[model samples]
Each structure stands twice: as C-alpha cells, then as structure tokens.
Target: MTSKYEIRLNSKIDIRRIYTNETLPLRKKVLKPFLTEEECINPGDDLTSTYHFGLFQENKLISISTFIQEGHPDFLSTFPYRLRGMATDTEFQGQGLGGILLQHGVEYLRQKECDFLWFNARIKAFPFYEKLGFSYYGPLFDIKDIGPHKVMYKILIPK
Candidate 1:
C-alpha cells in the first residue's frame, strides 16, 4: 500500500495528534519489517499518557512517532519523557517534515512542563536530531538487529 504524493515542497504539512495504531503502518514499513504489524505495536503505546504524533501530506500519514512518560536512567529531570517509534515515509525523507513533526510534538511536553525528552536515536539520524537541539550522549549502542543507536535528549522549557 502506497500513499499518493500530492503536496509540493512548499506545501504545509499538517502535524496532528494520532492514535497509537495509526503509527503502525510507517513503523512497519520503515523501522520494523522483521516484525509483524502486531509486533510493531510498541510496549507502553496503550498507556494513558502515551502520545502519538503523525505528519500528514495530502491527508496521507507520512511520518509518525510515539512519546511516553519515561525517564533515562542516567538523566535526571522532573518529568522525563521518552520518544520512540519515529519513522518518516521513505518517499518523504529529506523534506524536513520530521523536524516539523518534532516541533509540534515538543509543544505537548512544553505544556506539561516536562523537564526533558530523551530517546535512543539511530546513529544515522544523529545529525537530524542535533539540528533540532538534541544532544547525544554515551557511546554508540545496538538495538538488537536495528543497527547502531545512541542516546539523545533535549531539555524542555515550560511557558
């Protein structure tokens, strides 16, 4: 199944709150092909505080991410949140939609006065997260068969 690409580079992509299940398609196609769709459902996804954010272009969900209220063992914060299951549709990669999605999702944490956000980012996407002001710490690590990953986090400010 493929989504039709009807939006141009300058078009505004809609970033919206989505349900946990809505993230499975992109998660399966981009991040977890080795696992079944049912397996793509990440742990804690159904938790009351867990949130899913999706990027839509031409009404097609092109990028998705999951956020949970969890803290990094080495990082201390009042309300530490973790981001996971981030995937951008291959066709929509390099279009800056991922950053836009992050900016939108960060607002949620900002509203809740979260102290920081952290995630294990794939090494290849380290620069992308860096561009969004996230700092990488610790050494590169592997997530099972998912290649190299490193811990990244950003401090949040509440207004």
Candidate 2:
C-alpha cells in the first residue's frame, strides 16, 4: 500500500491557515495517542509561541506538527519545550514521517542550545518517544477529554 508522499523540514510552514478538512485526517491518526481533537486544534488556532512543519503529497498538505515553547518563565529557555500536533493523514500513517518531523525539530532545538524537550505522550506512544531518548517524568496526567498522558522529557546534553 505504498503511496507517493514525502516529508521535508519546512520552515515556511504555518499552522493558522490549515483548513479543517486537511487537518481532520491527521487528528484521527493521532487519536490512538491523543484522544482530544480539540488539543490538536487549539494551538493551531492561537499560536503564541510555536514552530511548524508540514507533510505533503504532490503539493497537498497532509499532516502537520506544532512545537510550542515551554520552560520556567523567569528562566526563558534557550531551547523551547514543544507540544506537537503530530497528525498524519490516514493514508500516510506508519511511513515514518512523524520521526522525520521530530528529528527536524530536535535539530533546530539543538541549534538553540535547548536544555530539554518535553511532550505529553499517549500511553501507546510512550515507547516511540523512549526510542528517541525521552524519559518519562512524574505520573500520568488526565485530560478531561483526552484520557491519560505520560509526561516525557529528554535532557539535552551540551554538544
């Protein structure tokens, strides 16, 4: 079931204009790990501090990830913590595009001298993040609409 799709590090990507139709498919894919459709959409609607990446197939937007900056406010992180939209089109799942986006984000984070990278990973996806060297911190937290999530973080060793 191979399809013509590609994942690239897109700097010009924007989250704001993504139409619901284009965004919905990826949301469905993420439901396995992130059950809240609204969490996927909220950051896109009002992006205060986030970076964007796009997944495309022949010029069509198929998936997106949003990296939100997080850290102690007084500390003002050199490396921003991120919460990813991490949605892939139903047709594009299991093709390793999510890893591509995550790698790309880490490269950028590395350049910024980030001390840590964190995300609320769904229980099903904990192993995925673990493969990336992110360790779980604290107990799982419940989202009113999305069930439980494990907080995972990777401490970036200085290069």
Candidate 3:
C-alpha cells in the first residue's frame, strides 16, 4: 500500500509554525543520525521567543527548522535570531522544501522586526543558503562531530 506521505507528495504543501518536538525526527534522521533523541534537542528550543517552522504535505512533515532569539557576539544587530537544526527528509532532498520553509521563517522574522537571522551552516549547504540571500559571516570552523561549517547570516531589518 502507498504510505500517506507518499500520497501527499503530490498534494498541496503548507508552511507554518510548529512545536519544537515536531522538528526532532527529521533533525535526527537528516541532520544528526548519530545522536540520541535527547541529544538532538537544540539549546533554547523551549524558549518562549524561539520559533520552529515546518513544511508539510497533508499530514506529513517533510522539512523542519528552528529559530532562537539569540544573538552572536560577532553580529551587532539589536535583534538577531539564530537558525538551528534545519533538515529536509532524505527522500525529499533537492525539492526546495527547505528553502521554501526558510523563506517563510524570514517573513515571520521580518514581521517581528528582527535585525538579522544567522546560523552555522554546514559547508555542503553553503550554496543552498547563499541562493537564499544568506552571506558567509566568518571563517570555516568545525562543530566537533558535525564537520566543517561557516557562520551565515541574512539581514532582515538593517539598522
């Protein structure tokens, strides 16, 4: 029998705010398979100001991302939101689901008058982010078990 998710692949897609827990399965599967379920939870995920976004087709969540109202010391923005645990299911890779979800988050941040959105992006995902207007912020660095990554940011409300 075809799974509900597979059936929804051709259905309408929706992007909206989702709970932090809703983001974990995809985070573990696509972004941190080596980590335990508890380890997949990112810092500040439960904060009141934190926001999680998901792309869903029917009832199936295909892509997920989390944003925290935390600022990097390097960024002088008065209101900076940090992106974390972004993942698109392997079967849904290259479908632009992640980008569409991210853009939706950007619009949400813009509405909140955020100054910028920043994150430590995996080296391989650089082009994906760059295409969406995020610029590299600092030199490449290692995130322990995660390999090479660079700080990337996009200004939402310039100061």
**Which parts of model 3 have CA positions greater than 4 angstroms off?**
1-11
Cα lDDT listed for each candidate: 0.85, 0.60, 0.85
lDDT by residue (tens digit), candidate 3, 42-98: 889999899888888776899998989999998788888999998899998898888
- Candidate 2 structure quality by residue, lDDT tens digits, 72-156: 3333446656655666666766776666667666766666677777777888777667777788778888867667897777777
TM-score of 1: 0.90
Instruction: State the RMSD for candidate 3.
Output: 5.2
TM-score of each: 0.90, 0.67, 0.90
Q: What are the per-residue Cα lDDT tens digits for candidate 1 across 12-88?
A: 56666789889988899999899988899978999988888888887889998789999999988998889999899
Give the least accurate 10-residue stretch of model 2, judged by summed lDDT.
1-10
Query: How badly does each model clash, as a count of residue pairs?
Result: 0, 0, 0
